[model samples]
Target: MKLKKPIASLVSVVLLSIGMATLVTSPASAHTNAVSATCSALSVDLQLYAASREGSPAEGYTEYQWTRTVVDNAAWTEYVRYTYTPKKHGKADPADASSTPLTDPSHWNADNKTYDNSAVDTYIHSGNGEGSWFWWIATTHEAKTHLETKWSKNEPAGDGWVKTGDSRFHETSPAVEAKTNHVAVTIDGTKVENTDFSTTFTKNYPFSDKYTSHTYSVVVTAWDDPMGTHGWTFTKSGSSIACTPPVVQVTAVFPEPVAPTCTTDGALPSLPTDQTGITFSWDENNSLKMVANADKGYVLTGATFNIYEKPGTATGDCYVPLEPVTVAPQTCQVGDGGVADFSGGSITLPTIAGVTYTVKTSGGEPVTITDGKATGLAPGDYTVTALPAEGKILTAGETGWKVGEDGSATITVTVGASADCSVVQPDSKVTSTEWADGTWACDATTVKQTREVTTTPYIWVDGAWVLDTAKAATVTEKQTRDLLASERTVCTEVLAAPPNTVVTIVPPTCTADGSATLANGVGYTWDKTSFGPGLWTATATVADGYAFDNGSTYQVTFLVSPKLTGGACSVSQVLAAPPNSGTFSQVLAAAPNASTAAVLAATGATPLPLAIVAMVLIGAGVVLQPRVRRAIFTRH
Candidate 1:
């Protein structure tokens, strides 16, 4: 018979028992009591074994036996009682049941149900009519059980589960290894041991096989397990792999600055031959090296420095030679000290000589050759000299020439003033001779003189001879007294004459007291002091021999004046007096009577008035006398 153990609680056992079994001989004698009924029948094998072997017919039967060997009585006090309930009914006939041996404990506990086998070691009991009775067993042996608990299942309803008391029969679990780089594994069943495997094992195992294939989940949590303490979880799959960090590269870029070029024109500077260096500065900020080339030369826009030739070095071409004069004159004497003479005897000076020269006069005026003219000579001397044009000097064979035996002389021929002879005569006596008495004699003769005047001559005064007049007649002394006496007698006679007398006396023509008298008349003197003419009182004197007429009833006349009249007279003639005197009454008493006067006057009368008076008498007689006669006859 096959006996099955409950996979949840009971274990199965297998054992070998030796026993004698008799064969029943057919037709043989009667059997003795010792000849027991040899029951070589199959029995149920029962011992403590893993319940996983129950009901595995292919694994065959298992014999199990138990001995009460007390190793630890204290641990054995609480026994573990295992009971099995079979699902099938037990058969009454043992010959009809089948048996098989169980081999592996892994197959015995695999199923959750129990199986039945016809075995004497197992008791059967029924639970009313609910199910069939299988087996029940109680043992007092040391429990070989282990318990494993995860901290996640310490409290079943909360996050944990616990196995204690009757739950000690649970299966043991394998140990779980703890690791640093992977998920921690924990055993949950009894008889478990913690293993410290490598983290590589945790990575290889990933998760329990109940989860997805090729992809697994691990309990990565903070918990107290038999393995370790900490919390972590790693979920992995077939395609998951670790990634490497990326690589990077960095680079730097820089910019370059540009330099400037020189473009200055016409900037040649004067430098010393020994100059050491030249540094050029730019308007902008830059630094550059100067490279000299045959075509481009040196750049000067930016800064460029140069080291030059030394101070005393000679360079470049020499200066040009001085230009030559175009037209130079020949060598000639110049200035005032040098003398130039005419080569020939009749040389003339040039009209436009440019230089100065000394012109010496040999036998003529001292002439100076200046402004092309010979000056400073008198009129007579310069009349033979000539002059050149302005600004020229006398040269040899030019303006003038030298005569024979003369040295360097120029002849200036010019007009001169005339000679003056009026200065030769001075103010001296000039006489004229007349031939009187047939001899050469000088008498005073009147000669008219004139003046001779000139700007160049001395002054001349009048110096001619003059003549004198001859003297007149002289009177005698005896004749002069006779004439004076006759004049006195005539004056006395004239004084004695009376009023109304006419007396006439001739003047005495004689001399008195050395005075001359007249010869042609008498001398008479009168002083009619208080009376009219011909009535005189005698205060008259006359020359001797002159008579006085007094009371004679005659006219008196005296002569004391000159006889000359009505003409120019000389100084001696105008001063002479007449010698005659006459009475005024006698001249008045000699008048003729009227009728006799008319006859004598008729001989000397004017006929113009007589003729006019005769014409008026004739007209009046003819016009008025006849008118009067006619008027009278009418009246009668």
Candidate 2:
């Protein structure tokens, strides 16, 4: 049973510990509560601390109890009347007892005996109002068997009296015995004050002040001193606490953006429009300018300038004297048609005072020029003619001009290279002695030939050689020469002529024309005139692209005779001539009568066949007979 008691205590402790685990609750956050108490004169203060005042409702109930011992000494005495009746004597009268009070135990009598003498007794009773007890009232008396005497109080008799003697006088003592008392005082089952009170304890409570307020309960118990055996008394106190949260402030931060960049070498830069810190404008110099306030807490620093195009000056000149002017030249065989090769030739005119230039072909009309442009020229040799200003003479030899002493010049275009003698050769000259017969000899002439000569006659009046208006003249000397003997003989005597110089004349036929031909292919035209009957002379003219041999004409003579059968013939004849050196004369026979000639002239009459009695003569008196021959004739 003793072992069971210990085991039961262990089981109870384990059960209590396990139950406490389930009863435990989570606390707000991980923070613990702080509490403290202080004792002072007649006052006690309690304090609680925590992360915040808001948490599980706090429990701070306290009890103050006290215990003490005290001594109590109270005393009292009472008197009672007793009547004694003897057994043998009939009812004796009760009386008050004095000596040997019922309270005196040793004086008490018993054994169913009666008091022989009734006496009055005094009794004492003592109590602290906690309990009461009575003892038998005793007296020294002998009981009578038949007559009993009972002591009775004036009031009612209580128990604890053994009825030992029907009535006995009970007396109370005057002093009561002293007693020691144990006293205890308590509040809410706690001990304090007179019991030497001192204690320390800590307890945790859950609380939270995340939003609303929560207060901590902290109780303080105190007591006043118990004067002498008086139990201690106490009063309870607690601290007033309200949890409050501190105010919190929050700040926001943002990320900064990268600054925009610009270029100097490319086209116009596009500025950022969304940027708040940058501004753009044109300065007074018309240059692009940018400003940045850096309102976003950034630093702006760099070098900048305006870009533009600058105005510049350039110098140049146009010389009027070097202005282009053209005067084309032509190349040709002398006296033939040709064109100038102006493909590579041009000129620059000058503005010299009193100097003017004219252009024209040799032996052609002058061409007009206005402002360095000239009228077009035909295919021919040309000259750029000019005259020097007054008081300025032509520069000799360098101007390629035929300049005169009068200061005029011509730009003469040479037909060939400057050194070619064929283009610059001088005219030939011949001197011949005359025969004593008053005729020039053929092989006896002395020839004097002039050497070729070239001259630059152009005047450089305007940076170029130009023809002068006044040009040097080429002088020609006329010399007359008589024909040579061969020429004269050939001219007078037809057989003496050179074969190339021979002339053949055909005799005229009554029905056909006559012709003349020269063997040298030197074509000629003819001229004829009449010198009376049967006498006619004709002359020859050489054609173009041909020349007479040393300027002489040859001649041939021939004749024709006809016979007539009737006196005064009525027949008529006409003759046709071929191409010859000169024109031929028309021959007509006198009509047989004036009326017949009139009729012939009037009707343009046809001719009748008849014998002719006429004479035909050529050159100088040469004659021959006529014959009837058939031939064709044409007038030319």
Candidate 3:
């Protein structure tokens, strides 16, 4: 008969009994008080582990030791000592339970339960229950009584398996061995303490056979409440990880942790690459600083930045500083340089704060002062120079200054300007022209602004603001009328040779100063006096600042046709009477365009041209002929 004890699944238990068991046969005829019995075999196994085992991890690891024998004392005595290393996260597995047996104590002693089979069974099972179930555990007196009462009843060894007490195959010891591991829990890298952790587990015990295992259950829980939302999971292994193990190990494995997430805000847009964490410093009154912290194993990444007049944060009035800040420093001012205030007072610059200027001493290094103001300046002579912007000049401060005993002194520079000048233009009286009402009839005359006053010349440069040396003149200046071209009036015919006609000529004129302006001088010359024949035109030209009053004119007409006459004429006396004298100096001129032949014909000279008639008259009268032939046929 055998009792059972739970087996620790984390450890592999194996028990080997090496000592020989003595076989005692019931003597053919037992003495009235003698007894003897024979046994078959004996063994024990132990496999145990703590809550934290291989493939299992918690706060830390735990250690265990086994100091017991795995051999029977009534049979052979032998034992092994072993120790289990603490679980190192997932690396938690103890060596197998193996021991060398030796015949050390072969006697039975139930009084002490030591140096016996009970010790061996206890060592193998981590407890006496399961191991003892498979061991020969009866007391010395019970063993003798059991052999006499059941197997020694005159039964021989050859008798077909007679009842030997209640037939038994195994027995067990009383000692129980157990182990425990520390319960630990953690999240990320932080430990979880002060919390009870547990897990439900079953410990199987040994069978009725000497070498089998027994089982029971022990519940343990491991948990970590770090940042409750850290999100963690727990699982058991070595049993049903993916498949069930023939011998359960009850291993608890915790997978690698997922880094916890921490959302950050108010970080700088542009962070340096090397520095993943941020630290800031500034005065809240004027400026702000922002920084960012990268997650573990990462560095700050760089980013672009955009400047703005104000932060466009949605938290309206809520302002949180990401870093410390500092404010700008204050400064004092003395004066500025510009156009000297020539207002009779001290010609000096004005005061302005925080403006920079460079002060250069003759031989010393240059020093910069703000607002042209300096306090506790090294005593010496120095020339203050203005570092004005480009395109600007030091208009107000250009002289070197001596540094007086006064520790506080000022210098300034100025900018901006302009100048003015005046000159007089000579004024001349503008003449009012009395122009006759013009008639536009083909032959009628038309008049215009025929003459203009000339501008006066002055000793001055072009574009210069000249100062007038004398008063401007106000007088009627006569215009110089120069004849530039001439034209004549055409007469058709006035006898053969006509008298010259005197015309009223009006010359085109301009001011004398026009020569300064016009490359071509101005004026028009036309023949208002000389009147004659065929064709004519009035031409005009101009100097600078002047133009012609009128353009060139078209052709005029001239004719030599004559007219008939019957009344008395100027040359009638000479014609009626022949010239009695030696000579007649003149002949009568004909009216313009009249036919002289027709006129003489009307005088009854002849029906021929005047030249032929004159020839006939001279012949008749000089030779004192009786009559002129051309007149002979007339009705005188």
Candidate 4:
């Protein structure tokens, strides 16, 4: 019979000898001295067959040599039918049990004269269980015994399956294998140091099962964080990513960074051709930096830049995003050997002839402009103007221009100066002559006269010459005169008579000088000191005369006393006294001699008788005049 083994001890067996008459029998003989005894021992023994096996459990794998047996000490050999039962024991009867021959039979023990079958039920036990086997034995008599065997304390195979996927990536529900991956173990709710725990899971497989993919991608990546509203981000491959526990992947994607293009708010004259033409990077303050490549003699002016996020990108490890800012525009002249780092590649500024402007009588602030259009302007009648630069002029459009409501106006500026204007004048000449005032000549021949002349004046107006009537003087004349020699007045102090005729002699007086007789004797004595010692002049007219004309006038000049000689009574005239005629001369001759008259008159006698006697003596031609005068003087 098969026996059962306990958990902590060896198996207990209950053996009975079976006596069946209607079954196949071995022998039917009994001895009188032999007592009827039942089989009492039934046991199961275990032995280790192999320590390890293929496809074993992750915790531990084992194999063992197993044996089951039943034995009795009596010297009777019999046939028994044994049956294995998982639940019941000792119910098999020899009348109904199958009498199949054993694959391995019992052997006889010579020392004890006993029989035992230890190899009756032999199999590999992979798990722990409780089992039993029943047996029916036929002895040499009619008595029967039934036996039951049970066994326990067999070990189980494994805990469960385990996982063996890649460790670089994590999944929510992971794949596993038996006892190959670290599994958490916990007493209550707390975990322990249990990485070696495992389970038997059928879904665990290799990681390359999903690696074959199709897409257009590159190793280079771009990062962005516009205004730094969010953290840095970069675009990754659709087949690759990073993760934490409970998930894992093996393929690594290393992407290089691509250069971003430079941008501006205003329009540029040229654009970059490639990445090298304009490069965007970071500065020492982690700000965005842009550098450009420019040609010779080119310059950058009035260009500004700001940071912008590259769209549709995820942050990579090597890239960082910066805050948004607008970089101030810079001016760099490549011709002056300066760097074009502040500009984009190949910058060409728009040409503006004149940029200065003004608002005519408008007090508003200057308006901002974009592409020559005024912006932020209020609605009004705005007169927009374009002012010229230094050393230039508004030669064409000097007048103010009006702008439409849309602030649209065309300002044409010309750069130049205005024209010039000047002149020269003429010389003066003589015109006429006239007589001078307050002059003596003929009667009205020294009269005053008038001369006349003319002149014209001009002025300049609006680049041309015109008559200046307001400043022009009227026709004017000047007065002057010329003197004549015949007009000079002559003055005479004394008049002398002709010599040798009878005349009366005027004796010298106290206030007058004496005068001598002339041929036309006239008694004329004058005071010489009346006029000063100088040339005296007077206009002379002829006195009334018998024959000479008296209507004409002439000039006479007299040399007064001391001017003529040293004598006080001396005088001279440049012209003779007027009125000299033959009758006037005869009158002078009729006069007696002034010396004779003076001699007779000084005698103080009767002049008629004496004069008659003197005349008879003078007429008697020979009478000595001195003798006659002596007689007369003696007689007196």
lDDT of 4 by residue, 1-636 (tens): 143345223422221223343222322111001111112211111111111112432342223322333233435546444544333344422222232324322321112212355343233111133433334344454334433232222422333222222122223343433222222222213333233212211111112212222221111110112222221112212222212222222221112234332221222122234432233233345233333433223333333233323432322222111111111222323322222222311111122353344432145455454554443333333334544343333332333333334333323222122122123222232233442244443333333445555444555554335566566554556554543555443432222211112222222222222221222212222222122223333333323321112223433332222212245635432211112223212111111223334433433322221111111112211222111000111100
| Candidate 2 structure quality by residue, lDDT tens digits, 455-527 | 3244334333454435433433334444434443211211222223334444434333332333332322323
Give the residue spans of candidate 2 off by over 4 A.
1-351, 414-636
Clash totals for all models, in order? 115, 50, 72, 56
Error of 4 at 28 (Å): 99
Per-residue lDDT tens digits of candidate 3, residues 312-343? 33322221111111111222222122112211
TM-score: model 1 vs. ground truth: 0.12
Best by lDDT: 2
Better-scoring candidate (TM-score), 2 or 3: 3
The parts of candidate 3 lying over 4 Å away from their true place are 1-275, 278-294, 299-403, 412-417, 421-636
Model 2 CA lDDT for position 89 = 38
Clash count, candidate 2: 50
Judge candidate 2 against the unseen true structure and give its global Cα lDDT, from 0 to 1: 0.34
List ranges where model 4 is wrong by over 4 Å. 1-408, 411-636
Instruction: Give the better candidate number (3 or 4) by lDDT.
Output: 4
Error of 1 at 417 (Å): 3.6
TM-score of 4: 0.16
Q: What lDDT does the true structure give each of the candidates?
A: 0.25, 0.34, 0.26, 0.28
